[model samples]
Structures are given as structure tokens and as C-alpha cells.
Target: MSLVRVAVIGIGNMGAAHARTLVAGEVPGAELVAVCDVRQEMESWVSSNLPASVTYWQDAEQMMSSGTIDAVIIATPHYDHPEKAIQAFRDGLHVMIEKPAGVYTKQVRKMNEAAAASGKVFSMMYNQRTNPLYIKLRDLIASGELGEIRRTNWIITNWYRSQSYYDSGGWRATWAGEGGGVLINQDPHQLDLWQWTIGMMPVRMRAFCSFGKYRNIEVEDDVTAYVEYENGATGVFVTTTGEAPGTNRFEVNGDRGKIVIEDGQLTFWRLREPEPEFNQRFTGGFGQPECWKCEVPISGVETGHPGLIRNWIDAILNGTPLIAPGEEGIHGLTLSNAMLLSTWTDNWVDLPIDEDLFYEHLQQRIASSNTKKDKAGSSSQPADLSQTFK
Candidate 1:
């Protein structure tokens, strides 16, 4: 286990990028031994882009059983993530799965169970956790600097995708293919970070989701969800893949202070006296707690995908703790699925969502979903995904 041999399954846009990073020796103690994809066309592409020593396989089982890799990076579709990771774990291989875990919690729970039994290193591609700003925000909250959280709001609408983007892949926005729209594909990082920094999951959620509002797809393109925590704290999450010049502002207000993160800058308003304390003792109705607005200084770059992969490799080689465990991925997916379920049922969904009901509703959507037919001379060309990482 000195040099962990790795194989990447699914050589799509993101998978190919992970393969390239491994081939370029970007992760120390990680060796790219093989790559797997069902499409035979990718064989030549891997041969041209990666090293000659890198082997290619069209079958995942063959690649896993070839004894060439000690680990596998599952970068497949939303549905295949759980199945592939389970297979890799059963085969005694470490796994680093791409985000959202899976479409639902029922399946992701099984994958986590298998990983727990296999005693293998399991990590998720929650690269946003590596961002220094978020890291600092998490620290501030955990340290109780922002006393008890009152409310949290995040307006993340920067995930703009055109109709052509939806037409690029057959599974782009379909219920049967990619599961859900922006929530599953584009906003998993933010969704994960939302709960991660806040350090709590909502006890109940009510959401309004607009399906195909901006695109000709079957899933939601716009969504607004209201959540309530056990401590009586509330939150509003608003997102859409439609608006241009979109906003990505996150604000959290607490009894002692308030923190706002936007445009790579973090601003904190410190109250000289706690809001609750000031409110209780103040005699004047017009008086409020005095505050000092300060810009929090953050160092280092926002290490994206590469940093996450490096940490995963280090977790395997040096027993370093994972930034995002594969098991915790279910929390974010729970929130996403709950939102969709709330819209589907037209009711507030309770926490630890009813997996059976959610799965049934999802199945109904898949049953009635219209498959997108590919038009002639409109083949999907891989876009430069580097621009999409935030």
C-alpha cells in the first residue's frame, strides 16, 4: 500500500479530468493504473491523453478484478454512484465517490453500510469544503462566536445552464437518468456546505420547486425551500439555474453576531452585547445592540477538485481524516430529496424523510418522463468543465 494504485470508472467530462489529474501525478502516493468506461470510443481517447502504462477497460468488473488497482474513483451517473461504490468496496478497494452520494437516501445508506463493513477509506467529492472562506465560517460557528443561530439564507443562482447544455446529454435533466436538476447536479456542494457549516439538519422542510421553468427538461430548474431546525432556527434556500449575473451570497444571523460570505469576501458584524441580552435590558424601544462591521481576513486559495483528491489520497496513505465522508453525503441528498418530495406531495416533509414515499414518487416521475431524442448533427461535445467549478 505504499503507492495506492487507482482506477477511475466512467471517463466522462469529470471522470476524464480526474484521470488526467492522476496521470499528471497531481496526487502524491497515487498511481493511475487503469481507467474504465462503457463507451469503446473512450479507449482511444485515454490512450492519447494519458500515459502508455495506463490501461483501459470497457467493463467495470474486469477493471476491478484485474488486480491492478487498490482503489476506485466512481465518477459515473447519479444512479450508478452507489452501485459502483458498493461493488468496489465488496472487492476490497477504497472508494472516492463524486457528490450527491446518489439520488436517494435508501440506496446511499446501503452503500455507506457496505463501506463501513469493508473497512476501506470512503470519501466524497465535496471540494467546496476545501475553500478557505467556508472553512473559516465553519470555525466561526463551531467556536460559538456567532452565538445561537437565528436564521440562515443562501441565494445561489449561479448555476446557469442553457437548453443546449440540457440537450448535450440524454441523461442531462431527465428523471430516469440524472434524477433531479440543479439540486442534484449543480448545487450539491452548496447544499452540503449549508448543513456542514450550520452543523445541523432541518427537522422539517417545505419547498416550492418549478419544473422545467427555464429549460425543456423534466426536473426542477428553480426552487425555494424553507427549513426548520430542532433549536427553532429557520433557513431559506433559494436557487435557480436560469438567472444571469447570478448571486451567491450566504448570510447567517445569530444572537451575538452576523456573518456574510459573498464574492470571495467574508464580513462579520460583531455585537458589543448579545442581541437577546440587549433586547431584554434595553428600556428604549428605539435602541438596539451596538455592532462593529469587520471584514474577516482569509488566506490561501480555494483549492477545488485537486485538493479534495489529494486529501483522499492522503487519507488512504497516512490515515488523515476525510474532509467529507461518503456516509455524510446522505444528509445533503436528504435535503434535496425532501425538497422535491415536498413539492411533489404539496406538503411539508419531515426530517429523516420517508424513503419509501420519496422513492415511490421518484419512480412515478421516471415512469412518465419523456425521453429526449437526439437530433442529427447536434452531437454533444465535451465542454471545458474547468470553468464550471466554483
Candidate 2:
């Protein structure tokens, strides 16, 4: 296909922004053929904003079957991501799904299988992968400049959401609607980046999650998770959507050096020798390895949503490699699921968790969920998503 005709499903906050980006010709090889949303307001918005050539459909199935699009961008709620992607793949369309994959692995695994079977370009909206700072960090670790990773810590608490934000949509922070809270919603990018840069998934996870600690929602708003890797490396992930003037510091210590990313800066402490080699050769008992602190220089601005979408379109049209393949979304989701499962079971959940048990617990939460009633009373409005990208 010379040009990949695209349709965006679920014209909510993120979806509407995506539609606008495509309509503005932000992605060179992509065309906004159609947009879909069940909300009545979106049809009016389309009439006011989009060109006549860009069609709007209230039903997604009709738009997909109308043969107007070769690809679909699934930006619906958390639960609909995998389901819609699966359907799109079945209909022989490329798919770019939003984060967290699904609330649980069982369903997402099926979606991944469908994508593989369809042999279509499947990608995820992991825009953080496009950040030059993170790209450099991943390169540093992969090149062995940082040696063997010893520890990892990320304190990302800046995802502050007001009660009005939650009240904007019934599915904003509910078990039955959006699945979980901060972990599923705000921490997907960090969780994806954490494992992506470190190049490993924790074999065991012990987490403590506080449900509705600072919010009126049923899902968790605060969490602290500890994990251990197969190589004996440990990691601590702490996050909350409550604190103001919040922190976004990610630190990783390795045998040869340490790297920290905070306040849009990347700092690296270079060791003269690897710690293992230094310890073996040192005679002085009260000494540490010589270290030089350097500010790592990074070029290129973060492309964010547009970059990922462009990459997806390029992959579809030019057979280029995807920056964030949809299948790998399972890794970060596994982390989130392990954390929630650990809290739910009050125990350390191992990697390759018991999906059946996790599903059971999640189903119990959904059975008693209060948000289903409030879904009808939804008063969702357009949100300024620019601030939420970080």
C-alpha cells in the first residue's frame, strides 16, 4: 500500500487528538479516511472540524467493513483495546493499540495470537520509546557501558489527576470500566520503559497498593512494588497520582557506572574500573572506585504520539521495523498485573503469574464494581492531553 488509510476508533481525549494529528497531515504516509465514536457529541465535532473527505461513523464495525481503511488505531477504554484489535486483525487490517494491552494477560495473549495469525503490522502507542533520553539510556545499558545492572528505582508521582478528571468519565478510574487506576492508566509508559531499558523482566514481584487512598475511585491511586531479576538484580517502583510538585526520577546502578534521569536530564557516573574488577584488585579496605559524573548529551526532541504513529505507518507502507511492537506490550502489563495480584493475594507473585487466579480476583472486583451504574451518567469532555504526555 502506497498510502495507509487510517480510521481512529473511540474519539475521546486521546483518540480525538490522534484524529486531529492525522487530519493535519502530521504523518506523511498516513491519511485520515474515517473516525468512529459512539458518543453523539463526536458527530457534531466532526461536522465542525474535520474536512468533508474525512468521514465520521458512530459504529466502528460499519467503518471497518466499509473498506475505507487499511489500518485502525484502537484508543478505546482499557478493556476494548485487545478486543477491537483482535477484530481489526480478523478483518485484515493493521492495528496500533493503546497501552496496558488489556486488564489481564489471558485476553491480551489471544489478541497477540490474532495479530500474528493475521500477519499485519501490529504496534502499540508506546511513545516514550521515542524520547532521546530513554533511547540513549537503553543504548548505554545495551552497549555494556553500564556493565551488569545491580538496582533500579523510579519515583514517578507526577500523574496527578483531580476529582473532576475522574468525574469526567465513568470509566476514568473504575474496576469494571478502566480496569485498575494509576498502574494501568498512568504507569504503563514507565513500566514499559523500565523493562525496556533494563532489558529484563523481574522474576518475582512483591507490591503494596493502596486503593482509593487519595481518590474517591475504587481502584488503586498509590503503589510501591519491589521486584527481583533472574541475575539477582533488584528494582523498586513507586508511583502515585496524589502528590503535587511530584518527582520523576529514574535511577539505575550497574557494576561499571550509574545512570539517573530526572528533570529532563540524564546524568551518568562513570567508574574508572568495573566494581567487580576494582574490588578484586584493591588493597585499601576503606576505598571506593574512582567515579566521574558527566551529564549525558542527548539530541532530538520526543516525537510522542505522532512519532509512534509515523513509525507504525512506515512499518505498514515500507516494511520498516516497529519501535513498539504490539506483542511486547505484554511485558509491562505483566508487571502491572503482578503488582495488583500481589496486593490482592497479599503475597509475592512470581513471573508467568497464575492467570486464572488473577482473573478470578479481577472478576470479583468487577462483580461488585459501582462504576457500571455511573457509566450511564458519564459527562466526559475534551481534555488537554498535552500536559498528560509526560
Candidate 3:
């Protein structure tokens, strides 16, 4: 197909943003044929905001079977993502799902299996992967310029949200609705980037999660997770939606060099010799590897969501590779699930987590979840998406 006809499911914040991008014709060779959402009220919004030729459907199945689109962007809730993407793949359509894949790995695994069997292009909306800074960082580590990794640290606490934000949506922060708070919602990109850049998943993780720590919600709002990689390298991940004037600092220390990314800048420290080799050969008791601090040059536009959409379209139309494959999403979800599971069980959780145990525990939390009632005429302020790109 020369042009990809696309439909967007879920007219919520992120979904609506995708629709707008498509309607604006920002993605080359992509046509916005239809938009779907379970909410009937969304029809009017879609009609008014989108082009006149775009169709609106209250049922996703109807739109999927309409034969008007070659692909569908599933931007629905965390739980609905797998089911909808699976259906799209079954229907022989390319699928691009929003982040977090799903709340549990069991279902996401099934979705990935379906995508594999269908032989369709499957992608995830990990827009942060398109950032030049992260791309450079990943390249550096993968190239072994940093030698053997010794430590990794990320203090990403800038995802501040208010009580009203939670109160705006009935399903905002509940275990049954949104699964988890910052980890599942705001920090999925970071979590994905964390493992993606390192090119390794932790073998085990121990986390302390604070539920309802900063808001009147039921899911975790703050977390501190300690992880150990297969090669005996250790790392710490800390995130929270409770801190303002927050920090977003990521550091990777290795035997030969170190890389730090913060405030949209990447700084690299290259050592003249490997730390291990220096330690063994140096005669002085207190000597360190000679280092040269260099400001890494990152030259590329920050594409964010629109860039991902374009890439997904190109992947389907021209056999281009996807930046974030649908199957790779499981790694990040595994880490998030492991963290929550560790907090719930008060122990360290192993990688490739026990899917059955995690699902059972998640089901229990959903069964006992207490959803908050939305106030009359109260809604979450339109997210200032400008600040969310990083």
C-alpha cells in the first residue's frame, strides 16, 4: 500500500493527541480514516475537532471490520491495549499500541504471540526512544565506550501531579482501573528507556513502593527500586509524582567512562584507562583513572509522538524497522510488575517474573480496589503536554 489508512481507538488525552497529529497530516503517507471510543460524547468532539471526512464509531470492532483502514492505533486504557491490539492483529491490520503494553505480562505475551502469528508490523508508542540524547546514550553504551558497567542511577521525580488530577478521572489511579500510578502511567517511557539504553534487563529487583503517598489514591505514587544486572552490575531507580522542583538525572558508571543525562544535555567522561586496569597497575594508594569530561553533541529534532507515528507508518508501508517493537515492551512491564510485586510481597522478585503469581496478585488488588467518585463538573486540567516530552 502506498498510503496507510489509519484509525485511532480511544479519544482520551493521548488518543486524542494522536488523532490530532494524524488529522494535521504531520505523518507522511498516513490517512486518518476513522476514530473510535466507547464514549458517545466523544463523537461530537471528534466531529468538531477533526476533518469532516473522518468517521466516528462508538464500537472499536465496528471500525476494525469496516475495511476502511489498514492499521489501528490502540491508545485505550492499559488493560484494553492487549485485547484491542490482539484483535487488530487477528484482523490482519498493523498495530501501534500505547505504552505499558498492558497491566500484566500474561496477557501482553498473548498479544505479542498473536502479532507474531499474524506477521504484521507491531509497534509501541515509546516516543522517548526517538530523542536524540537517549539515542546517543544508547549508542555509547552499546559501543562499549563505557567499558563494563559498574553502576546506574536515575532520579526521575519530576512527574508531579495533584489531587485534582486523580479526581478528574474515575479510573485515574486505582489498581483496578489504571493498574499503578507513576510507574504504569507517567514513567513507562523512562522505565523502557532505562533498560533500552543499558541493553540489559535486571536479573532481580527489590523495591519499596509508597501507595497513596502524595495523593488520595490507592496505587503507588512513589517508589525506590534496587536492581542487579546479570553481570553483577547494580542500579537504583527512584521515581515519584509527589515532588515539585523535582530532578531528572540519569548516570551510568563503567570501568572506562561515565555518561550522565540531565536537563536535555548529555555529559560523557572518558577515562584514559579502564578503572579495573588502573586499580591493578597503579602504585599510589589513592589514584583514579585520568578522565576527560566531554559534552556529547546530540543533533536531531525531538520527534515525540508524531515522530513515532510517522515511523510506524513508514514501517508498515516501506518495510522499515520499528524503534520500539511491540514484543520488547514486555521488558519494561516486567520491571514494573516486579517492583510492585516486590513491594506487595516484601521480598526480592526475579526477572521474567512469575506471571501467574503477578496476575493473581493483580487480580486481588483489582477486586479490592476502591475507586473514587468524580466531583460534579470537575475534570483534569488539559495536560500541559509540552513538559511531558522528556
Pairing residues by index, what is the TM-score of model 3?
A: 0.95
Instruction: Report the Cα lDDT for residue 317, model 3.
Output: 86
Candidate 1 wrongly placed segments (more than 4 Å): 372-390
Worst 10 residues of 3 by lDDT: 374-383
When sorted by lDDT, best at the front, the candidate numbers are 2, 1, 3
User: Could you tell me every candidate's TM-score relative to the true structure?
Assistant: 0.95, 0.95, 0.95
User: Local error of candidate 1 at 187, Å?
Assistant: 0.6
The number of the candidate with the highest lDDT is 2
Q: What is the lDDT of residue 200 in candidate 2?
A: 95
Candidate 3 residues 264-332, lDDT tens each? 899999999998888889998777889999867788998999998999899998989899899989989
Q: How accurate locally is residue 300 in candidate 1, as Cα lDDT from 0 to 100?
A: 74
Query: Cα lDDT for residue 28, model 1?
Result: 92
In model 1, where is the ten-residue run with the lowest total lDDT?
372-381
For residues 1-390, write the lDDT of model 1, one tens digit per residue: 789999988776678788889888899999999988776677788788889999988888877877779999887777888888998998899999888799999999999999999999999999999999999999999999999999999999988888988876676788877788999989999999999998999999999999999888999999999999999999999999999989999999999999999998899999998998999899996888999997777877877888888998999999999998888999999999999999999999999999999999988888887753222111122524553331
Model 3 clashes, total count: 0
Q: In model 2, what is the error at residue 321, expressed in angstroms? A: 0.9
| Shift of residue 125 alpha carbon in model 1, Å | 0.4
Report per-prediction Cα RMSD to one decimal: 3.0, 2.3, 3.1
